[model samples]
Target: MPTAAHAHAHALDLGRFVMASPSSFHAAAEGARRLAGEGFEVLSEIDAWPGGPGKYAVVRDGALIAWTVPEGAGATTPFRILGAHTDSPSFKLKPKPTTGRLGWLQAGVEVYGGPLLNSWLDRDLRLAGRLVTLDGAQHLAATGPLLRFPQLAIHLDRAVNEGLALGKQQHMNPVWGLGDPSAEDLLGVLAEAAGVDPYEVGGFDVVVADTQEPAVFGAHGEFFASGRLDNLSSVHAGLVALVQAAEATDAEGAPIAVLAAFDHEEVGSASRSGASGPFLEDVLARIGDGLGASAGDRRRAFAASWHVSADAGHAVHPNYPERHDPANHPLLGGGPLLKINANQRYATDAAGAALWATVCGEAEVPYQEFVSNNDVPCGSTIGPLTATRLGIRTVDVGIPLLSMHSARELAGVQDPWRLSRAVERFFAQAG
Candidate 1:
C-alpha cells in the first residue's frame, strides 16, 4: 500500500496529465514529451532504428508506444506490455461547424461515442484536436472555455421535472457566441489558438471537452473528479510504471517493458492508431527485426509474452447497486479491479486471474474482482482485441470508477496510484 502523501502526489500528477490531454492527439504528444524528458529517444517510422538496448518511443497519429530493452535482451526475450487507450466519449466537430440561428452562434457536432448526454448539459466546453495543413503538417490546437450547452429553462416546460428529454440533432448543439453564422468561422478560432492560418488547415479532427479543472474533493479528499478519466487513468498508470521500470537498475533479466496507448477505443477502435489495427504489430515486428530474431524465435518470444489491458470498470454505485454483480461489488478506494467476463468481453481467464493475483501480491496492493450483473451486458476493452490480434496472453484490469462516460467521472484517489504500483511490479517480474 502507498502512503497517503504518495497516493496524493500521484493523483495530482494524473490530474495534470488529464488537463494537458484534451484530445487523443494531445494525449499522445504529452506522453511523447514526458518520455523524451526521461531520456527516451524518439523513433521515427520513416527512419532506421538502432538495435542497441535502450529506451525508445514512437508515435503514430493519436497513439504512442514506448519500451525499454534491458542490456542482455535477446531474440527470444519476452515482452511485458501495458495496454490502454487515450480517447473518451464526447462530441466531435463535424465539417462546416459554424452555424447560427436567431443571433446565437453554434457549432455543429456529432456524438463521438456513448457519453452521458444529460451530464454534458450546462457545462463549459472547449474545442481540441489536430489541424492538418495542405502540406500535410499537423498542428495541435486547444481553446479555452469557448462553448456551452445550455439546458432549456424549467419555466418554459413545467413538466421538465418529470423527465428531461434531449435529442442528438435537435438539442445537442452547443452555443459559442451571439453572432451571424455566415460571418463567423469556428475553425479560425482553433487555428489562431494553434498559431496557424485557418486557410492552411486542409483537414481537422476536433472534439469537445469539458473545461473544468480536475478536483480532489469529498470529506477526506478521497474522491477525484475529472473528464477523460475513463481511460486516461489507465494510461497514466502504465506510463508512470514504464518510466519507473526503465529507471530501475536491477532489470538485467526482466523482459522488455512496453506502454502501448492506443486511440479510438471509445468508438470501435478500427482506425490505424487503434488496437484492432496494425500499429502494435508493426512496432513489435520492427523491434523483433532489430533483435535479429528469426520467425521461430519471434514466435517463441510472443508465446511467452503478456499484455495487461487496463481500462476503467464500473464501481458499484450507491444508488445503482443492482446494476453491478450482487456477489462481486467493486468499490472505489478498495483497490484496482481485475475485470472478468464470461462472454469474453474482457480477456481475463483463470490463468490471467492467477497472474493478476501474483502481480498484486508482489506489489503489496489489494485488488478486487469485477463482473457485470447478469441482467446487464458488459462493456469490452482492448484486452480481447489485443489477445485475438496477437496470440499473447492478456488480462483485463482497471481502477473502479463511478459515473463512467460522463463529461466528468469520479474515482478514488488511491486506486490510480495502486494500479501504477501493480503495473510496475508486473513489469519487473520476468515473463
Candidate 2:
C-alpha cells in the first residue's frame, strides 16, 4: 500500500486532469504537454525519423503516440504498448446550432455517445473544443458555464417519478438565454474565448460539459468523482508509467515502450484519429522503416508484442447489486480489474490473462475481476479492435468505476496510483 501522502497526491493530480479536459482535443493536448515536459521529442507525421534508443512522440489531430526505445533494442524488438482512449460521451454542438423557442435561445446538440441524459439535466454546463480560423490555424477554447438544461417540474408531469424518457432532439437542447438566436451569437462567444474575431471563427468542433469541479470524498477521502473518468483515468496512468519507465529503464533489454491514446472510441472509433483507423499501424510501420528493419522483422515484432487496453469498468453499484455478476463483482479501492467476456467483446484470452496476472503479482498490486451478468450483454474497449487490427496479443483491464457514462463518475482514490505502478512494472519487463 502507498503511504497516505502519496495517495492524496495522486488523487489531486487526477482531479486537475479531469477538470482541465472537457473534450478529446483538450485531452490530447494535455497528454502532449506532459510528454514534452518529460523530455520526449515531438515529431510531425510528415517528417523523417531518427535512429536508436530515445524518447519521441507524434500527434495527429486528437490522437497521440509516444514511445521510448530501449537502450540496445532494434526495430525487431517487441513492443509493450499501453492503449487508452481520450473521448467521453457527451452532447456535441452541430455546425449551425443556434435556435430559439418561446423567447429562449438554445444550442442544437447531437448525442455523441451513450450518455445518461438525465444526468445532464439541470446542471451548469460549459462549451469547450477546438476552433479553426479562416487562415487555417487551430485554437483551443474553454469558456465558463454559459448554458443550462433545466428539467420540467413534477407538478407539470405528475408521473415523473415513474420514469423519464427524454427525446434527444426535442428536450436535450440546452438554453443559453432569451433572445433571437443566431449563429453569430454563438460564434461571437467562441471567438472571444479563442481570442479571434467572429468572422475568423470559420469552423468549430465543440461539446457541452458539466462545470462542477471534481470532488474527493469518503470517510478518508477514499473515492473521487468527476467526468471523463471512463478512459482519461487510464490515460493518466499510462502517461505517468511511461514517464517513469523512461527515466529508469530495466537492465534486461526490454521491448520499446509505447503509449497510444486515440480519440473517438465512444462513437465507434471510425474517424481518422480513432482506433479503427490506420493511425497506430501507420506509425508502427514508419518506426520500423526508420530503423532499417526488414518487413519480416516487423512481422516478427508484431507476433511478439502485447497491448494492454485500459478503460473504466463498471463497479458493483451499492444500490443495484443485482446488475453485476454475483461472484465476479469488482469493488472500489480494490485495485484494478481485468474485464473478461466469452463472446469476444473483450480481447482477453488465457495467454493474455496470464500475462496480466503475472504483471500484477510481480508488482504486488491487489487486483479484481469483472464479468457482467450472464444475461446482460457486455461492453467493449479498444482491446478487441486493436488486437483484430494489429494481430497483437491484447488484454482488457481498468479501474472499477460507477455511473460510467454519467456527466460525473465515481472511482477509488487509490486505484489510479495502483494501476500506474502496475503499468510501470509491465513496461519494465524484458520479454
TM per candidate comes to 0.99, 0.97
Candidate 1 TM-score versus the reference: 0.99
Name model 1 segments beyond 4 Å from true: none
Question: CA lDDT of each candidate?
Answer: 0.94, 0.88
Candidate 1, residue 218: how far the Cα is off, in Å = 1.3
lDDT (Cα, 0-100) at 309 in candidate 1: 97
**Candidate 1 local lDDT, 89-207, one digit each (tens):** 99999998999799999999999989999999999999999999999999999999999999999889999989988999999999999989999999999999999999999999999
User: What is the Å distance of residue 101 in model 2 from its true position?
Assistant: 1.7
Report the Cα RMSD per candidate.
1.0, 1.4
Candidate 1 colliding pairs: none
Best by TM-score: 1
